[model samples]
Target: MLIKNYRTQFTEELTSIFDEKEIESFFYIILEAFHELKRVDLVLNPNLELDTIQLLQWETVLSQLKEQKPIQYILGETEFFGLPFYVNENTLIPRPETEELVEWIIEDLKIKKFKDLKILDIGTGSGCIAITLAKNLPNASVFAIDVSEKALVTAKKNAELNEVKVTFIEKNILETEDLNQQFDIIVSNPPYVRNLEKQEIHKNVLEYEPHLALFVEDNDALLFYRKITELATKNLSKNGQLYFEINQYLGKEMVELLEKYNFENIELKKDIYGNDRMIRCVLKS
Candidate 1:
């Protein structure tokens, strides 16, 4: 069948499940992933045909998409901070808000002129934040930890895929007593979504993404943050800074949480949507 014909049918079928813009994006993203075809290629070659094998592949993806599966997981890869990452059920697909957290850290490093700094990423799903930081901040020693062995495996694979050296460790942040070594920076985009908030999450996310990485108990919404903060007090070097990509609705509580630990320069910054989504704290020497 001609590619354009399949594209038209694909859009019409998915319009009910997803909006027009998202359906269009899924169409082209699949084309690029499966056939090295871009939007321009489709425009230039309007009559391009899809062979039987290719059609079968796309049919499978279409079935999954109809079931509310996320396109990122269906594709088994995603882009973050302009770098490619491998993702799956084992890892949460990197979110744009988390990308913003990475940017804040990178910008801070550029301003400080810091080098050879030791950095740790807590619960580093897919190793997106840790790997990106390692790639961008060449002089920084990056390490990542996660409780899920399956997730760590994916994260390790991502580190190698991105050609960044990050030490991947399998450890539960909540159960850990301490990080034996000091780090110039410690950052976590940990589980901050409360169980009650699941209704607020998209069906694609709630159904396809790993809940271990996405959720927290409503009674203890800051459990991971509190644990990481405690660990940072012992693990953070003099004048070290900590960063968090927090739950948007809990910004005020996050401020109070950091202040309880005496984290100085506690700044709550909004993401592109102006939701309070990122926080930075420093411990002075």
Candidate 2:
């Protein structure tokens, strides 16, 4: 079958589930992932043909797309911060907002001229934050923790895929008392979404992403944040910094929570969409 005609059929079938632009993106993404073909290749050769086996593969992806499955999960990989990561139902697909959080950390560390620093990423699904830090900050040692063994498995693969070393730990943060070692920086983009906010989530996310990595009880929306902050107080080195990618609706509560821990130099920054998305604070020496 001609790739262009197949793309048109794929688009028509998925137009109800996703917008035209998204459908187009999925088409090209699958093309590259499955056949190593790019948009230009299709454009330059309008009659590009897919063999029977390749057509079957594309059709399988099309069916999954009809179910509103995320393209990343179907592809089993994604790119974050210019590096590749393997993802699955066990891990949340890395988001651009989280990339902003990472960029903020990298920029701050670079500006401070810090080196040989110790860093930890709590709830490191896919190890995106921890691995990226290790890859970019060659002088730093990175550690990551996740309660889900399956998620940690995927994260470990991602670390290897990115060719960066990160210590992966399997433990629930709320049940832990100490990190056993101090870190120069502690960061987390933990489960902050409230159960009540599930309706606000898209079907692709709510159905396809891991819930353990996405939600907290509404009565204790700060569950992970509070626990991690307490651990940071006891585990951060002098003048250490802490960062979080937070729920936009609870930015004020996050600030209050940090202050209660006596953290100084608090700062909350927004993502590209201008939502209050990330917070940074210091543990005073």
Candidate 3:
């Protein structure tokens, strides 16, 4: 069967479960992953055919899509910060918002003229942020810690894929008793989503994505933020900077938490959607 024909059928089948935009995105992602074809390829060569084996593979992926599995997991890899990263059920899929967090870090480093900077990424799922920074800032020493050994394995694979050296450790952020060496920068996109908001999330995420990397008790939504901030105040180098991708609903509270810890230059920035999504603060020496 022709690739174009299968895409149309796949889109129709997915439309029942996902919205028009999501279905379209899914179609494009699958095409790229399975056939090495882009949407433009389909447009230019509408009659391009898929062999029987390819068709069966496409059908299997389509079935998973119907079941609301994430395309990143389906492909077992994704692009983040212009680098390819391996992902799975063990790791949280890197998001564009987190990419923005990486950009902020790079920009700040450029302005500081700081080299050989020691940096730490808390809960570094897939090691996207740490690896990206290590790749972009060659002189920087990057370290990442996550509770899940499986996630750390995926992160290690990503670092190797990007050909960047990063130190990956298996440690629970909430229970971390010490980080012996101080760091010039600390960054995290820790679980800030309140459990009560689960219903608002799409089935594809709530059902398939790892909840251990996604949720917090509604009553303790700032749990990770509190723990990381406390550690940063003690373990960050003189004038070290801390960054976070935060829940929009609790931006003010997040800022206040940092302020109480005496972090200076606390700034809250919005994402493309104009929701408060990022925070950066400097820890005084």
Stretches of candidate 1 exceeding 4 Å from the true structure: none
Candidate 3 lDDT at 206 equals: 89
C-alpha positional error of residue 261 in candidate 1 after TM-score superposition, expressed in Å: 0.6
Winning model by lDDT: 2
Backbone clash numbers for all candidates listed: 0, 0, 0
lDDT of each: 0.92, 0.93, 0.90
Put the candidates in lDDT order, highest first.
2, 1, 3
lDDT per residue (tens digit) for residues 77-132 in model 1: 99999999999998999989999999999999988855569999999989999999
Cα error, residue 26 of model 2, in Å, equals 0.2
Question: Candidate 1 has what TM-score?
Answer: 0.98
TM-score of 3: 0.96
Instruction: Estimate the overall C-alpha local distance difference test score of candidate 3.
Output: 0.90
Collision pairs in model 1: none
C-alpha RMSD of each candidate structure in angstroms: 0.9, 0.9, 1.2
Candidate 3 local lDDT, 78-133, one digit each (tens): 89988999999999889998899899999989999665699999999899999999
Assess the local accuracy of residue 283 in candidate 2 as a C-alpha lDDT between 0 and 100: 86
lDDT of 2 by residue, 1-285 (tens): 888888788889988778889988998899899878899988889988999999999989999988889999998999999999999999999999999999999999988855569999999999999999999998899999999999999999998898889999999898999999989999999998999999999999999999999999999999999999999999999889999999999999999999999999999999999999999999866
